[model samples]
Structure formats: structure tokens, C-alpha cells
Target: SIKLVLKMLDRQMAVIDKNIDGMLKEHFAEKLALFKDFKGVGPCMQAALMGALPELGQLTHAQIGKLVGVAPLNADSGRHKGKRITWGGRATVRTTLYMAALSAIRYNPVIKTFYERLLANGKLKKVALVACMHKMLTIMNAIVKSGIPWNPEHQNVSKNA
Candidate 1:
């Protein structure tokens, strides 16, 4: 009985995925096309960006980073400068970006070199990955905002990234 239930659930999930795929291809075809040349951004990333972060291209780089919770907020007071920590945002988008950054560090040329440079400079592995996520998000924002396909020139969203 349990096996039958699990099988039915799997079938329903597959159908739902198919429906989503068709919807995106139909209504969001242009938007999805924007990601065609971008590395590390697959169907899942596209869907996450469209569904979870609808404010993608409309916002600035810093706004997008904060929306994804990748922006580190400094906990500072009058004279005491506290640590910069990241917390609180849309978790689904952040987590999806996390996985995409992992792939980007391996495949994306710009991201790969940046990740390696950070490691060479003695930044922690986690910190480097987070930074890559920021870069990836900013690049995507620039692409969507400009309505241009991916290019290395879009990488320069800011000095830090």
C-alpha cells in the first residue's frame, strides 16, 4: 500500500514539473532565453528567479543581494565595529543560488578564477562561495536589466564583486 502511494506521489510530481516547464517556456520564453548563454544558471535557477525573486531586474545589485540574504550586514554601533553577518531573506532563492554558485565555481570562467583568487588570498571556502553567489546574482541582474545576453563585461557590477 505504501509503495503504491509513493509511486502515485512521484507521478503527480512529474506531471507538475512538466506543467511548470511548459508554462515557463510559453509565457516566460523571452525571460528564459536570457539565461541561455549564462553558465551555472539552469532551468531550476531560472524558475527560482522568476518565481521567488520577481523583483530581479528592477532592483539594484545591493538590493538584490539583500533580497537573497547574501549581503553581509555589519553589526556596528557608535564606536564598536562589529562583524558583518548575513541573515534573513528569501531562503528558497538563496539556497538555489548556493547550489548554482557551487556549479559556477567549477564551470564559469569568471567565477572560477574569482573563487580561486579568493582562496589564494586566504579567504575561507564558505566566504568565497558566498561572494561568488553575490557575483552571480549581480551578473544576472545586469543581464536581465539590460536585456542583453550574458557576457564577461556584465561581471563588473561593483568593485567588490
Candidate 2:
């Protein structure tokens, strides 16, 4: 009985996936196509981003990070310095981006290199992953803003600002 229920659930998820793909093709083809060029942004991630972050292209890199809850915030008070932490934004978007960053660290060259560099600098795994998520979001924002596909040679200018 459990197996049967699981199978039914899987079937339902498949159908939902199919419908999402069709909708993306029909209404958000350009955006979908652009996101598809990103190495680790699969259908689910693309859909989550498209639905949650409608201001993708228009916002600055920092704004996008804040919106997704990936931006590091200072926790200091007066002379007592505190660690930077991320807080308060769209939970679903952050969760989806976390998963995408996991995949990207494996498949995306830029993300992989950045992750490795962070680790080399003694950053914690989670810290590095969050940074990677921020970088990925910035890149996506830049791409959408510029109306260009993923260009390996293109540096994210907004990241430095």
C-alpha cells in the first residue's frame, strides 16, 4: 500500500512537471531559455526562480541577494563586532537556490571554482555554498538585465559594486 501511494505521488509530480514545462514554453520561453543556459538550473529551479523572482532583471545584484535571503547581514552592536548572517526573505526561493547551488558547485565551472577558492581561504562549507548562491543569483540577474545568455567570458560587474 505504501509503495502504491508513493508511485501515485510520483506520477502526480511528473504530471505537474510536464504542465510547468508547457507553461514556461508558452509564456516565459525567453526567460526559460536564458535560465536553461545556466549549467545547474534545472526545470524545477527555473520554475521556482521565475515564479518567485519576477524582478530578476531589474534589481541590482545586492537587491536580488537580499530578496532571496542570501545576502549577509551584520549582527554587530556598537563596538562588539558580530558574524555576518543571512536572514529574512523568501524561504522557498532560498531553499530552491540552496539546492541549485549544490548542483552548480558540481557542474558549473564558475561556481565550482568560487567554492573551491572559498574553501581554500578557510571558509566553512555552508558559508561557501551561500556565497556561491549569491554569486549565481548575481550572474542570473546580470544576464537577464543585459538580455544575454550565459557567457563564460563575461564577468559580473555588479558583483564588484
Candidate 3:
């Protein structure tokens, strides 16, 4: 009976997921396509982004990062300099971005290389991951703003230049 109940719940969840996907495609097709263009960004991340950050394309990268609570803020006061830390803003968006970043670091070429470079440069693993999350967010923001799909070649050229 317990197993049957679990199976029923799983089927319900699958149906709900399918419905959400259909609704997102129907209502936010363009935005969903933009989000899905990025490597490792899937339907769930696209839905979360579209729902939580309706202003994604309208704001600057720094502004979006700050809004999502991923931007590092200065904690300095006169000569008493302090480490920059991220705080405040929408926790759900931040968490979603973090998950997206984790996947990106594994499968997205630019993200993976950038993450490795940061680690090689002696940055803490968590710090590097956060930086990757911020970078991914910025990339997505720019993509949405410019109406361009994710292009690793373009990103590489810009980085070199």
C-alpha cells in the first residue's frame, strides 16, 4: 500500500511538471528559450528564473546579482577593511542560481574553465563556486538583454579582448 501510494504521488508530480512546462512554453516561450539556451540550464531553472526574476533582462548584471543576493558587498569602514560578502535579497532565486551554477561548472565549457582557473589561482572552492554562480547570472542577464543565445565563442573572444 505504501509503495502504491508512492507510485501515485510520483505520477502526480510528473503530470504537474509536464503541465508547468506546457504553461511556461505557452506563456513565456521567448524567455524560456533564452534561459534554456545556456548549457546546464533546464526547464526547472528556466521556470524558476522566469517566475522569480521577471526583471532579469531589464537590469544590469550587477543590479541583478545584488537583487538575487549574490553580489559581494564591501564591508569596509575607513581603514578597517573587511572581506566582501553576499547578503540579503531573494533567497529562492539565489538557491536556484546556485544549483544552476553547479551544473554549469560540470557541463558548460566556459563555466568549467573559469571555475578551474579560479581554483588554480588558489580561491576557496566555495568562493570559486559563488563566483561561477555570479558569472552565470551575468551571462544569462546579458543574453536576455541582448536577445542573443548563449555563445561560448563570443564569451571567449570577449574575455581575451
Candidate 4:
């Protein structure tokens, strides 16, 4: 009986996945095509971009970062200054972006290089990871704005994603 219940749940999940795939293709075909070549953007990230942050291609890099909670903000109060940190924004999208950044750190050359550079410069791993998330968001914003697929050589990450 337990095995049957698990099988049923699996089949339902497959159906949901199929429905989501179709929906994404139907509404975001152009964006999906452009995003396909990006190294760390998987199904969850795609869904997050489409559902949680529909303003993906519509905003500037800085705007997108703040909207997704990846940009570091000042946490200072007069003489007693606190550390700069990310605050506010779409929590769901931020969580999804975190996972995507982790993947990019491993596989995306530009992001991997940036991460290593930060680590060498004495940034903590978590700090570097957040920077990567911001970078990835910048890259995605550029790709959507330019309507260009991922081309490592012709990257628009000049703003340094």
C-alpha cells in the first residue's frame, strides 16, 4: 500500500512537471530559448524567473538585484556601522537564485573565476556566494534585455555580472 501511494505521488508530480513545461514554453518561449545555453539556469530557476520575478528582462541590473534581494545594502547607523547585507525583496526568488548561483559557481566559468577571485581577496564563502548570485542576476538581466543567447565570448556582462 505504501509503495502504491509513493507511485501515485510520483505520477502526479510528473504530470505537474509536464504542465509547467508546457506553460513555460507557451508563454516564455523566447526567453527560454535565450536562457537555454546559460550554464546554471535549470527548471526551478526558470520557473522562478517566470513566476516569481516576471520583471526579469524589464529592469536594469541594479534594479533587478534589489528586487531579488541579492544586492548588498548598507546596514549602518551613525558611528556604529554594521555589515553590508542583502535585505528585503521576493524571498522565493531569492532562494531560487541562491541555488542557481551555487550551480554557477561550479560550472559557469565567468562566475567561477569571480568567486575564486573574491575568496583570494579574503571574502567569506557566503559573501562570495551572494556576490555570485548578484552576478548571475546581472547576466540574466543582460541576456533578456539584449535578446541574445549565452555567448561566452560576446558576453554583455561588461557591467561585470
Best by TM-score: 4
Candidate 3: tens digits of C-alpha lDDT, residues 1-161: 99999999999999999999888889889866766557878877788888888998899999999999999999999999999999898888888888988999999998999999999999999999999989988888998899887777895688899
The TM-score obtained by model 1 is: 0.90
Give lDDT tens digits, candidate 2, residues 1-161.
Answer: 99999999999999998998898788888877777668888887888888888998999999999988999999999999999999988888889999999999998888999999999999999999999999999998888898888866456665665
Best-fitting candidate, measured by lDDT? 4
Ranking by lDDT: 4, 1, 2, 3
Q: Give the Cα error of residue 48 in candidate 2, in Å.
A: 0.6
* TM-score against truth, every candidate: 0.90, 0.90, 0.91, 0.93
Each model's C-alpha lDDT? Answer: 0.90, 0.89, 0.88, 0.91
Query: What lDDT does candidate 2 reach at residue 145?
Result: 91
lDDT: worst 10-residue window of model 2: 152-161
Backbone clashes in each candidate structure, one number apiece?
0, 0, 0, 0
- Distance (Å) between predicted and true CA of 20, model 3? 1.0
Residue-level lDDT of model 1, residues 55-93, one tens digit each, is 989999999999899998999999999988888889999
Better of 2 and 4 by TM-score: 4
User: Residue 131 error for model 1, in Å?
Assistant: 0.5
Give me the runs in candidate 3 sitting further than 4 Å from their true place.
Answer: 156-161
How do the residues 1-161 of candidate 4 rate in per-residue lDDT, one tens digit apiece?
99999999999999999999999999998998988878889999999899999898899999999999988998889898899999899999899989999999999888898999999999999999999999999999999999989876564556566
